[model samples]
Every structure is written in structure tokens, then in C-alpha cells.
Target: MCKILFINNCQLYFIIYISLPTLEKDNEIIDIDPFTVFGLFNKSSMKEINRKSIIKYIADEFNINAKIPTSFNSIPVLNNQNATFYNFIGYRNDSDIDDLWELFSSALDYSKNPTQANRDKVSKFFDRVINQKGNGNSKITMGLYWISPDTFLNLDSRNTWYIYEAGKIPDNIVSILPKVEEKISANKYFDIMKKISEYLKSSASNLKNFKELSFEAWRYSEEINHKEKSKKVQSQRDDKGSGLADEDVDTIHYWIYTPGEGARKWDEFYEKGIMGIGWEKIGDLNQYSTKEEMKKAMKEKINPNGSFMNDALATWQFVYEMKKGDIIFVKKGRTQIIGRGVVVSDYYFDTTLDSEFPNLRNVKWTHKGEWEHPGQAITKTLTDITPFTNYVEKLEALFSEDNDGEIFKEQEIEYPIYDRNKFLEEVYMDEEDYDTLLELVRNKKNVILQGPPGVGKTYAAKRLAYSMMGVKDQTRIMMVQFHQSYSYEDFIEGFRPSITDGGFEIKKGSFYNFCKKAADDIENEYFFIIDEINRGNISKIFGELFMLIENDKRGNSLQLLYSNEKFFVPKNIYIIGMMNTADRSLAFIDYALRRRFAFFEIKPGFKSKGFSIYTKQLNNKKLNSLIECVERLNNVIADDETLGEGFLIGHSYFCNIDEVNDKVLSNIVEYELIPLIKEYWFDEPSKVKEWADYLRSAIK
Candidate 1:
């Protein structure tokens, strides 16, 4: 590499630009892709990266053990104990260490000779370890840096991405770094970082060290900051429009996204059938544990305004929260709707994508043209408009005009698998009990799972249907909660106000529509789950359909009071109702309704093999003690004349928790269990406090 020359002519300055020679070692050509990273946490905030301390800790701790030649204790273990640190990536657990230690030890030799041949060996070793193929490159580079920080810089994804953003990387770099999971030789990785670092150092006026170069790379890399934001140009298209066939309006989430200012990316995204966003510097967002972590990375690399919490949140939601089948209303400028799309795929970070927007999701663009929203939409990059039902309805109505009353249909079926075994593990129930419940539903056609709170009644109802159906099949399952105000008008067809009619139009209720859908597909069984079934006035809600719910009368046709049309409960439809027996405000189910449907008592299963296995696997003394105490309390409640077994404390409160710790136990005791206990024994204040103290002490 040629040396850059600087000449001082009086007080003025003259700088010379020189293209460096190709780096060679051992008579071999050295090639490394440009704009690859090392680090960038904005030195000022994360504490300056200490060079001497990092090297010293590596020398002391990371040296190979003679007893286990391929092993060098874990870096994360030292991190757990607050040992001296280095900021790097890809060592999530000790497995990566154990998997790559043989390759990792080679760094000591590479540092000694620092040959191109040896550097190539590290990358080749990574590919050989097939288990680590995805994250192999990350480990090798950081592992090499750990041994010799100065000789081999740790260019993490964040660092490489920033260098790309700074425009230091040539266009050809994409051919080399083709995907997020790029595998480059260690020789090439170091060569590229050295070239970029040297170039950054030579170009600056007062840059002192490599750390400052990191800060400069971060500061200079820019686009679409608040200052460059375009002025609002309202869309000239008319506000009113129409949409296509409606399905699952309640489940769909509506969103608005801009390809770029004035819809510059419309052609690319529309033709490719995709929608995407910038902020490619953060790498694959899935790696971030939470939205807050994604936001933190955005702050250091993208320099997003910390005060704009919603703006920061949009970046994370774009990758993780956005789901397939969600609606997207594409907009150009403020209030201008350019297109409508349905998400067809999950978010992916494709490095080969258009560099401007590397994060993407495949979309089926249904409509493309100019239309205006009834109101000015949120100006954020992405906005969830599902809450604005009226606005969404109007938007759909506008799209309905495109075909001039002629419309087409598009169907996408997604059946997530949830079989009987999964149901057994999750519901804290055994095979015999599960078989009985399924048989009861099939025989009775309508059954209520009556249990105390935390017995997993509602949880089991959905899964029971899943196990019966053999697939999750959300399309076949419909769940609705019934309350005091629920009625025939809400559960069946009813007249409601319409904008165009300027009068009332018959609007179909959720259950009525679901029944119609099920009736159309008579061969397949459909399950309808009603939560808090006892809360609503059953006679008022069911109306004439009350008699039809009986297994024999299911296929019998009935005339509706409102529409006067022949409607029959499909023979294939089954009902699963849930009743919280602990709710004392209500009386027993009507005798007329009770006899038609089977009532299944779902008891607490603390002693069930599933629950026992779950508890042992968690292996927490506090959790074990707490469960034993709850069991004793359940016995006391069962014996009480006022409460009995129906209102006993359930085991669901402790089920499926990720871990049993003091914080979780305390929350359950203070907020969940204690409140229920206070309500259960309201007449006896001392008793309530006694049980509360007992439960609290069990965890403590």
C-alpha cells in the first residue's frame, strides 16, 4: 500500500490522494470486501473500548486448557461474573465456544505468522462446522480479534453495515457480501477493515485513533434526517373509493407505508410484489431481544431522535410485529393513497435487496392508483390504522369501485399444526381426560367447560378444538366472549345504520356470518367457542336459535324474526362454552339450555403427570413450595360450605411460565392470587390476609 503525503505550504494545506497497492503476504494476493465493520456503539455513550484490558483478559482466560485442548472457558461466563469485557458479538452461549474452540485456537498462530494462507484456513474451518454455518463468520472474526485486537480488528455486522452506509464500499461489494450470512475468509475480512480504517484515518483532519474513526463513520453516514423531510403535498385523488371481497375484518390489521418520498420506489416494490423500509444498518432485527434493543441500536447507528418514541418503535415493528395477511395502504405524500396490498410473507433482512431498503416483506398489491384517505393519516413511516375502523372501512369502500361492481377473489389457507399431544402438554391434562372431553363435545354437540379461574378452561377449549380438527385451522375456529349486553342482534343478523343508504341496512353478526360460512362447507367440522357463556343472558342471546342448538335439532331449519329467511344450524357445527363457576353474581344456567348441552367440570390438575414434569423441569424451591401451599388452600376451599370444589384455587397460574423467580412469584401473590383470595373470602378479612400472608411466605 502506498503512503499518503501531506505538505504544509505556509498556513495553507495540500493533501495528496494515492491508490494503495494490493496487500500481499507469502507471495499471495490479498482481497477483502470494502465497507465491512468492526464496531460503532458511539464511544461516548458505551464507555471507550479499552485496548489493553481486552487483550489482557483474553490472554489470561481464553488460553487453551491442557486438560481440554479444544476448550477455553466461556467468555459469557466471565461476563456473567462481571469479568473485564470486550464489545463483540455471536457468543450467545458456551455452545459457540465449544463448537468453534478448535478453530478459535488457530487465532494464536495467525497472530504469530499473520499469513494469508492461515487466514483462509479460519474461514474454511467455519464452513466445515455445519452446525455453526449461519453465524460462523461472525464468531471467527470476533474470535480472531479477541486474540490479537490490533492485528485483526473485530468488524461486527453493525460496523460493516455502517461502512456501507458511509459510501466507502464500492458497488462490487454486493457481489462479495451477497447476503446477510456472508462467508468470507479471515484474511479477506481483516484486509477490508484495514483498508477502510486507513482510508477513514487519512481523510480526516483531526482524527486521533481508531475509536474516533468509528465516531466519524457514524456521524458522516446520513440520509432522510428530519431536516431533509419533504414538504406536505396532499394527493389530488378523491377521498371516496371502494374495496374488494371482505373476509375476517376483525382479524386483519391495516397499515400505511411509504416506499420513499413521492412514491419513488413504487415501480420497484410494485413490480417485485414487495414492501420494505430503510434502516439497514441495524442488521437482522430478529436478533434483537425486544423493541427497545432495536431502538437502542437505531440510536447509535441511525441517530434517530430519542424523544420520538413512536418513530423509534416503527423500526422494530416493521420487522417483527408486522404479520402476514395484514393490510397495507401505500401512500405517496400526505393523505394520498397510491396502492393497497396484503402482506404475503414474513419480514426478511436480504442484503442482496435494493441497498436503500434492505428489510423487506413480500406483498400482493391488490390496487395501484391515486386515492385519498378521508382524513390526513399519521405522518410516521409506518402506522397501524386498525383502531380507526371507520377510516379503514371507507378506504376499503373506495377500492370496491376499481372493477365497477365486478370483483375477483383471492384465498390463502394457513393451517398451523396443533395436535393432541401439544394440547396434553399445554393444558396440564392427561390422555384419558382429554379423550372424554372430546367425546363429550362430539356426543352433546354443545358443552360447557365449567372450572375455577386459572384452570385453563378457555385455554383448553381452543386447543381441544385444534386437536379434534388435527390442525390449528384458525379459519375453522371462532371465539367470542359473551357479556350482559350480548343479544340475538349481536349474535345473529340485525339492522344497522348505513352511510349510503341514509337509513338502516341489515348487518350480519359475527356468529351469523361464521355459521353461514360453516353451512357452506358442510363436510368440514367447525367449532364455536363462547367465553364467559354464563355472563350473558343466554335466552335473550340465543332467541329462537336456543332450540336449534340441541344435537337433534342442529339440521332443522328456523325462520329468523328480523330477516324472515330460512336459517339452519349446520350439522357440522359444534359449540364449546366456558363458564367460570367462581363468578357468584350469576345464577345457574337455564334448565331449558342446561339439559340440551352437556356440562363438563374441568378440575384443577396439580397432581397431573404433565404438571409434575413441568414443575421439576423448572426446578425452583420457591415455586414448589408455592404450589404445595395452593394445594392445601384448594382443600380448605373445597371443604367450605360457601365455596366447595368449584371455586378452588387452580394450577394454571403457575403453568407455562418461562422461569419461576421472586419477581414473578411476588407479582402473582400481590396482584393475581391475593386479589382472588380477598374476593373469595370478602366476609372474613382476617382469613383473606392469612392466606395472602401464607402464599407470600411460601415464595419468600
Candidate 2:
């Protein structure tokens, strides 16, 4: 007899649930009869049928006609009698059966008897399969022969074998499979397909390999389709305004995407959610209300006393025409009461004064059976009343009894103040004896500092600031280099649109800030140092300020459009500019800037005390040798328009200790001096070669 037991926590719920009526001895077990617990009954009782025969019967019912091997071999048993007799007949271990099933399933040939065309077709099928599946969130299910815990794991290994054996799968498909699997596990449906597609299109070889067909299966997954469903929600919203009724006003809140600095303002508006217009966008005057309730709320919150009664009365009339949530501007010079109190309230009549109450002055209040004298009520003003009604009537007109039409408007405006005296006195230099120099600058002070290379035309600008202002701090001096891209906006104020919640708001530029800073500090001298002043789009950079740079127009005030900011260059602010004549490609300095700033030719001053001390340390023989070579080259370059006096080697050359070495000297000859000579003396290579050879010899 064969017995089956169902055990939960070592406690048998049922013993001998089902038994096959067979052998005589109850102790002699023919099979473990694992399925006896299932209690599957057949009407036909076959006393001689083995476990393999029973399995074959079940397989036939399932339409699986594959052959089954006997006697617990590695091959699976298809026939019921054989499976029961050999594998499940007596005391069979479930673990052994599971392992056998896995081995059999893995060994099954999926590509058996496949023709060349069939192989190509499979490859093509998987190509599309991988592409579509890889690009989307989809799952491909391959039927497994078993249902053990390792079924999927076994299936995965089989699938990998099929993909690798196919060999025709694109590299991209193969590469993207692992990533797709990872994405699937993470449940990132949308990004999975996107990432897969990106990998397929990318130059990476892993994605190009089609060996891994799993990516193709994942691309077609249903989850990916769901992820792509709501991609255009925002676009749809933009296409159709808020779905509020035609009669009803819809408040559509939108965020302005400003590129760079505007991002901050856009975020602010998004967070604040349409709290009137951004202050940076508009001027001081602002309005708030879209509906009547909001307006009434504003009136209650803002307006209290019924003063300047006529304007308040007019506002009330305006409110009647306003729709719910409709914003309207309150004209200037409205009733003081409406202005003082942001809202309007109930209306009442006073009968104390009877002299034709249409004028507010004639209106009065009746108190305790006694008439109070009235000209303008203490609570109200004469201006508060209108010609059409008394103070009470005017107050009623201004005050909205019901909260109906309300509007909210933000005024975008900014007032930038520039201090004139403070800027000049602080930024400019002024001492008792040098007061005359400041005066000279006010009238005519044309000063220039000339020096050799490294002698520092650039360095002295800072020193000049110190000499003029007696302040060693370099921050007090403003330094700007002239470049072709440098514009007036960089040197002066210009309208630059900034992104605000409402829209683009124009703001001031750098020059405006600098001038504002200078304007605030006028007690000392301010030095504006322009390095490489000639190499710029001078007219474009200066704009109209080119004319204002003159002495006469120094104090003339100017206003910028975006901001109500007034600016003026003070007389005390001295303009010191440096120009390197060696840069032949640069255009001539702007005549306007030239007139404002003193032109100083900073040539190689070899005779200067600084240069003398710099050269005195050099060996006499080397100094003389260097001088002889420079003189010879100077003569050769004297007539060349491109190679002028600036090309001459300056005394600073001898000051550098490294330049004395033979290798460095040869490099100077080969790299710097030779190239320069070649560019300038193209037709005279012999002369160039001679000069180079002489310099090389002198250095050696």
C-alpha cells in the first residue's frame, strides 16, 4: 500500500489521504504516491497501471505528447505509468523530482531541426522583439515545463542560451538587456524604455550587441505604455485655458521660465502663487482683485474712513461694472476715504444739515433729536462727496455692499537713486596741494605713464589710485579691459529682461551698479582704469555715455528707462586708461574716450631709473651683446609698419635671470624672436635668420 501525508508543523492533518489499491502487503510500498493528497480520482480503475502510465495519462490530457524515459533516468517520463512506476512509484523524494525537471527543461532543444530560413526568421523575430520590447515596458513570457521555485531562474538561463546561440541579435540589444532587467526590477517603467532606446541609439558597443534578447521583450511591456500616457498633460493645459465657464473668470497661474538670473524670480512667483505682479517687473502702483469678493475684501482691509469722498464714490461706481475677480485700476486722486481704507462699506443718509445736501459740505448727521451743524463731517471731507450725491450717497457709491468684483494687480517699478556729490568726493582724489591737480582734471589734466614691458602700465593704475585717494585698497579703483564684445551695458546701465512670475522684467546692468556705488561715495577720488583701452568696440561700449564723459557734461544727469534711476559722472572721478601699442590688430582708441581720458604712450622706457636698475645687475659683456643685437634688429624693423618701436626688445629682457641661460635663450631665439621676425620680415628670411643667429650667439 502507498500512503500520502499532509504535514503542517510536523502535525499530520491527514494520513493515507489517497491510496492506490495494489500489492497485498501493506508494508511493501509500491510508490510514495505524492499526488495522493490531491485526491485526483479516475473512474477507470487500472490495478496494473504504473506511476509512469498515470503521468503519461495526465500529459496526454494536457496535450503534451513528448516521450518520457523510464526507471528514474535523467530524461523526463511522459507516460503516466512509467513516471509513477520509476520516479513517483515508491518513496520518491520531491527534491529529486524538482532537480530532474530543471535538468530536463534546460536540456530541451528550442532550436531543434531549425532551417537556415527558420534561423533567419528567428533572428529577425527577435530583432523586432528586442527593439520593441527594449524600447518599452513589456514582459515576454516563455512557457516553462515545471513550476518549482527556481522555474523563472531556470527560464532566464534558457532564454540567455537561446539569445547567445542565435548570434544574429544586434549588439545594442545584447548590451541593453541587463540594464532593462535592472529597470524592470526597480519598477521604473518609463525610464526603462527610454534608457533602452538611448542605449540602442548610443555609440556604446554593449548596446549595439543583440545577443541579449531580454531587452527586446522589456521594450514592449505594458508598463512602458502606461508611463507614456500622460506626457502631454501640461501641453494640453496650455492648449485649453482653465475650463471655467465663459461667464466665470478663470485664474490661470503660469510660471515664467527665465534663463539664468530670472530662474530665481520665477521660482519665487511659483511659490507665492500670483501675489499681485512682481515688484521687480513693475513700478509702485499696484492693484489686486479678480472678483468682487476680493475687491470688497480689499476695500474692507484697505479702506476705512470715507474721506476724499468723490473718488471713493467713483470707485464704487467702477466696482458695479467689475465682474467677479476682475481687476481694475483705481485712478489717481480718488476719494481719500477709499484711499485711506482699502475697502468700502454700507451707505447711510444724515439729515442734520438741510442746505441742499447734494454737496457733501451741506450734509450733516442727526444725533439724539439734535441736528449737528455740517460743513464737512468730521468723519468725512468735502472732497469726499460728489456733485451727484451727499457724503452718504458718495460713500455708498464707493463702498460695495456685496463682495462681487475684485481684482489684484501688481505694479512693477523700481526707483534707483544715484548720489552725485557723495560719488565724486569719495571716489576722486583731493589733497591740499593736489587740489590743483583735481582742478586740472576738472579743466584739463592729460597725464600719461610710459614704460617698457613688465614695467607695468597696468600696475600703476592701482598706485595712481593710492597716490590720488591716499587709500591703498585696490577695490576703490574700477578696472575694465576693452574687448570687442564689451558693450555699453557692461560700462553703463542698460535694459536687461529678467524672468519674473508674471513675465519678463527688465533690470539694470553692471555699469548702473558701479555708478550707483560711486555716487554713494563722493568724498574721495574714484579711479576708472581701462586696460587695453584701445581694443574694444568703443562706440558700442560707450553708447551715448561717450559724449557724457566730457568735462562739461560730467555733472549732467541722465536717466535709465527700465529703472527710474538718475546717474551722473562726477568731476572728481578721474579716468586713467592704458594702451598696449604692441597689439597691432586693435583699432584706434575712440576719439570720444580719448578726449575724456588722457592718452599715455607706455613705450619701452629703457632710460628710466627703474630700467637702469633692472639692467645694472646684468654682466656688462652680456648687456653690451644684447644691446648690439637689439640695435641691429631695430634697424631692420624700423621701416616695417607692422613691426614698429614696440617690437624692439625692452630693457626688461635683461632683468629676467632665466633669460640668461643658453637653452632658454635658444628657445627665445627659436620660438619667440624667430616667429616674430618671420611674421614681420617674411620677405627677408636671410635678415631674420642673421638676427636670430646673432641673438643665439650673444646668449651663448
Candidate 3:
């Protein structure tokens, strides 16, 4: 058994030395500082000491009076508190006491525990004390012990005890015990219980309950003050009006009250006549003087159901510019009232007041929903009047009964316009040839400018039409290319229906619609140009319109499929077709369609004046050399089986200035030209090779 005293902040334990034993030869009693025994100092400061020194220090201080182990069972006293407790049980040797004492002494020297576990335990214990005090009005003392007894053989000796400052112990000792327990005796149990109780009572007296009344009182005061302030703000608003009333005064006040409250107040105000005059009190609002007099005077000016009449009482007074149709309410002498209605028939006013009222003897009165004057004409002025009075007078004179009436006389009038000959001289084109083509366009529906490659065949058609029409806008012309897959169904209307309401609907195509638009625009001419006309399946693409392509059949209506929508090739629309002779695979253009279009060949002309200007711009020696080489090569290949006259190099060959470098020109000749020739003469690679060699030589 060991004697232990557990105080409020510290635990004291003493080992019992029941029997003395001889130590080993090397074991000697050593002296250790008290601070070292508490394990509070650093290891370096206690490096000169050992565990033996610590045990010797404690043993020397207490001498042999230190409590000894015995067969007696006694309860441990934990600092004057009355509570049940137990001792820490563990293994112990004589050497163990020396180790504990040395740890304690070194800790005391450093003013802190040497080990982390001991330091944390001490901190947590103090935290629990502070927290407990913070939460409630209670004080507590906790005790812990590191006990090692000689009888213990293992390491489960650490324990703690909690003691309340209350209660006492029983004294029936020997009688209450079992038979085996009666053999042992313990006399210190009652003393230990008394000490624990005394400690608790002393701790309880120092505690006080926490106060919270100040915070509670503050919250209650703030809530009452907020409610009182809100009531004051609402009361202020009730004394002032929001300005929405319907009185005749210049400054009237309107207020909104709680639903029932407003209605009650309204009834009170009405009884006191505070609401003033309403529209209903004004008199005899529907009397007018005469039928024609009202028509000429006031009939045109009244707007009875207008905004002003809708809320009549909302108007303050009738002081404004007076007009017909104005409902005037005037205050007459003491108890009488009078009302008059203005009747201005036209927008103008005569300003003459008529006192004699027209007779109502011939007029019959009829009852309708509202009051209205009978036999009165409603007068209104014509809107959007033009200032062309002279033009109107002249038109009336031309169709008058005194003269032979004619809306339009076919009288020839001369106007100074651009003379064709002078305009052509300024623009530098042949006037007779231009006018001939222009006349053909005005009379004909279809024309084709068939030419060899690169002769401005398409350009001539466009320029001639533009010059004749004196039109500078490029947007008026519609140009398209004809190919093998181009069809009448795409050009004209087809059964191209859309799924609408679970059924299909046919839609019109572009050509049919464009022609319809052209027919409607009778003053302007429309040009439809087709490039590469020979490459398309012409007869198939034209369909029944092949006959209508002629000038005589134009403007004749033709019915299409799916609907009775008639399509006419408008006379204003001229079709110009451009064909390239290089397209060898193209089928022969139909003879019937060919007769409709006049063919004009456009060939490469090196001697033309335009070609001379084109060549002069190329002043580069290499380009001139290239042209000369191509001309010589063309002479040789002209008689070849796979090459012909149309395949010869045109003046357009020297026009491309993009590839100014020799390397780029070589690539253009090898890649672009050779491939085109190879396609045309696939079975004759020798002739293709010769042509490429000539082109490559021109580049060098």
C-alpha cells in the first residue's frame, strides 16, 4: 500500500519501504535538486545527475519516516474532500523511484515539464478548470497521480480522482466487511474522507454565479423603442395628403386610407359638400341651335367621348382656346346655372355669336342611346392635300365639255437628251453598231455572243446594254452560268412542295418569279446573261419555252404545271448567252434555239489596238520574250492533230502580271497550262509534252 495526498492543483504520493534490502555494488545514494525531481528542467542542465541521485535526495529528505508498505488496506486521502477514490496500481522496483524523482527534479529546474505528454496534461487540466468556471457557478478540484508500488509488477499505475466537497463515511467497518476482508485492517479511511470533504467546502465558498440581467434588459428596451418610433412615422403621414383628388380647385389633396376607412370618410365628406361640384350637377348639355347653322358653326368641333369629357370634373376651369364641339359649363347668377355647346363645322371659326335659335318645327326628334342633332352634316377636311392646284386645273380643262376631251393627246414633244453619235464619240465606241445591237435588244428576247476564248464576248453584251439604257448601276444585271445539270425545274416552277399541316405545298422557282417581277416593272429593262450556254443541255433546260425564246413569241403567256400561274417572258428582259469554243465535250446547241440568238464570234486578235496597249504595259523583257516564243510555238502546233487554232496563245496570256518572278512563272506553266492541255489531249501526251516545252522555253 502507498499513501497518496491529492490536493486541488497537485498530487503527492509516497512509496512504502516495508523491508530494507542491500543494493548492488555500483548502486549508490546520490543527491539531486528539488527542481530536477519535478521534471521541470532541460536535460542539459541536469546532465551531471542520474536517477540514483534523485531517489537518494527524496529518501534523505523524508528519512525512514516515509510511509512504508504493509498488509493493511486503507482509503487514500485526496486533500480534504469526501469522495470515493482508488490508488494507481503498477509495477515498481527500487530503481523506478529514483527515475521518477530525477524526472521531477529536472522539470522543476526548467520551470516547465521536460516531456510533451506531461506538459499537455497539465495544460488541459487548467483549461477544464477555467471552462467549468465560465459555464456555471461551480468550483472544482481534480487530482492525478503517477503511482508505482513495490507490489505492482506492470505499467498500469497512473490514475485520477474527482472529489465533491460533501458527504461522510460509514463506521461499521469490521461487521460490514466480507469474511476474507475482515482479516485486514485500515484506520486512515475516515481521516481521508474528512480531509476531502473539508477541501470541497472551502472551494465552494469562493465561487459566485454568473450575471446575465444586463444583456436581457438591453434587448427588451430596444424592441419597445423600435415599435414606438414606427408608430410616430405612420401618424405623421396621416395628417398630410398625397395629392390625387378630383376637385375643381387648383390645389387639391388626395389621400389613401384603409379600404373601409376611406369609404366611410368619403360618405362623411359628401354630406358636408366638401367634395365640391361633380360633372352631374351641370345642366342641359345637349341643345344646339340649327341644322345648317350647327353644320357651318359647331358640328365639326365636338369630340363628345374624348378624354376631356370622360372625366369632366377633373378639369379645373374652362379658360382655354374655344373651339366647336367643346362642352362649356358656366356658373350663372345666384342659384342658376347655364351650359352651352360650340358647333364649329369646319376647322375655322367665324367668331360671331348668334342669339336667334333655329326653328325645330320641321325636324323630327328620334330617341337614340345618346343625344345627337338630326339633319346635321358631319364636316371634316380632306387629309394629305397636295399643292398641285395648277396641274389639277389643267387636267380638268383638258377633259372639259367645251373642247374635244382627251386624257392624253399624242402630241410629239422634243427634249434635249444625249445624242447617240456624240455620246459614242466621247465613249469611243461605234455608234451605229451599238444602236443596232440596242434595237435588237429592244425587239428581241434572246441573243447569244458566240466567240472563241478570251475575246470580251460577255463584256460587249454588258457594255452595249448599259450604254443604251444610260444606266451606271451594276446591280441591275443578273448573270448565271449554264451547266449540264441545270434544269427547267430549277429555272421555272416545279412541284417542290413543303410539309404544311401534314400536307405538301408546291412553291415557285426563281426564273418564273423573276419574269413575273419583270412584267410588272414595265418602265425598266432587265438583262439575264448566261455564260457557257453551249455546255448545258439547252433543250432540256429550256423545255416548252424553246419556241418562246424567239422575239415574236415573247410576252406571250404560257401555263405551267401544278397551278394556273401563267409565265411570260417579258419583252423588257433580254437574254445574252456567252459560249466558249474550248469546251469540246459540249453537245451541239440546238438549231431551233440557235436561230433565236444571233451568234457573233469573238477570237484572239493580237493586232487589235487594245492588245497594243496591254503589251506596252508589260514592258518587261522576259514577258516580250515569252510572247514571241509562244507565237512561234503556236505556228508549229497549229497543224498538229491534237492542237488547233483555238488552242493558240491569246493576248490574255501576257495580261497576267501576278507571276512577275521567273520561278513563279515556271510553276504556272508546268502546273496550270500542262494540266489543261493534258486533259484536252489525253491520248496524245507527245503533243502535250511539246506544248509544255514551248511554254517552258518562253519563261526562260
Q: After superposition, how far is residue 528 of candidate 3 from its true place, in Å?
A: 0.5
Q: Cα lDDT of model 2 overall?
A: 0.39
lDDT of each: 0.66, 0.39, 0.39
Estimate, for each residue in 539-622, the C-alpha lDDT of model 3 and write its tens digit: 777777777667888878777655666767877777878887666776476897778887654455455555555667666666
Cα lDDT tens digits for candidate 2, 1-700: 1123212212221322224433213334333322221112221222112334545544554577778434221111122222221133344344443333332333232235335554344333223322321211122212121222111221233333434344534665655555434113322322333344455456653444222334442333322332233122223322111211111222222111111132232222223221122111111111212234334433544564424244333333322221222221111122122111121111112222211221111101110111122122332111222221123323333433323344322332222222333223222222332344345444543343333244356544545455555434333455667777877766765554332244444444444545555677777566666766677787787666665667678779777544566667766566666666555575455566665665444444455444454456554565556656766766666666767666555444444463355665566567766676676677878877787778778766
lDDT of 1 by residue, 1-700 (tens): 1111111121111122211121222213222111111111112122122322322332344473334222111110111121112112332343443335545555556668868777666555545442342344444555455456555554555445655554545555434442334566544665675565565466443554444544454444322121121111011110111111112111446888888777799989999999988776766555455567767877866675665477556766676456678889888777788898899886766768777788889999988888866556667879877655556767887787554456645456766676888888878887798889889999999999998998989778877887888876766877788898888888887887764446777766767777888998998989888888999888888889988889989879899989998888888899988999998887577887788789988989898888999999999999999989999999899999999988988888887699777999998889999999899999999999899889989998
> Which parts of model 2 are misplaced by more than 4 Å?
1-455, 497-507, 561-564, 587-589, 618-624, 639-643, 652-660
How accurate locally is residue 69 in candidate 3, as Cα lDDT from 0 to 100?
31
624 in model 1: Cα distance from truth in Å? 2.7
TM-score of each: 0.60, 0.35, 0.36
The lDDT, on a scale of 0 to 1, for candidate 1 is 0.66
The predicted structure with the larger TM-score, 1 or 2, is 1
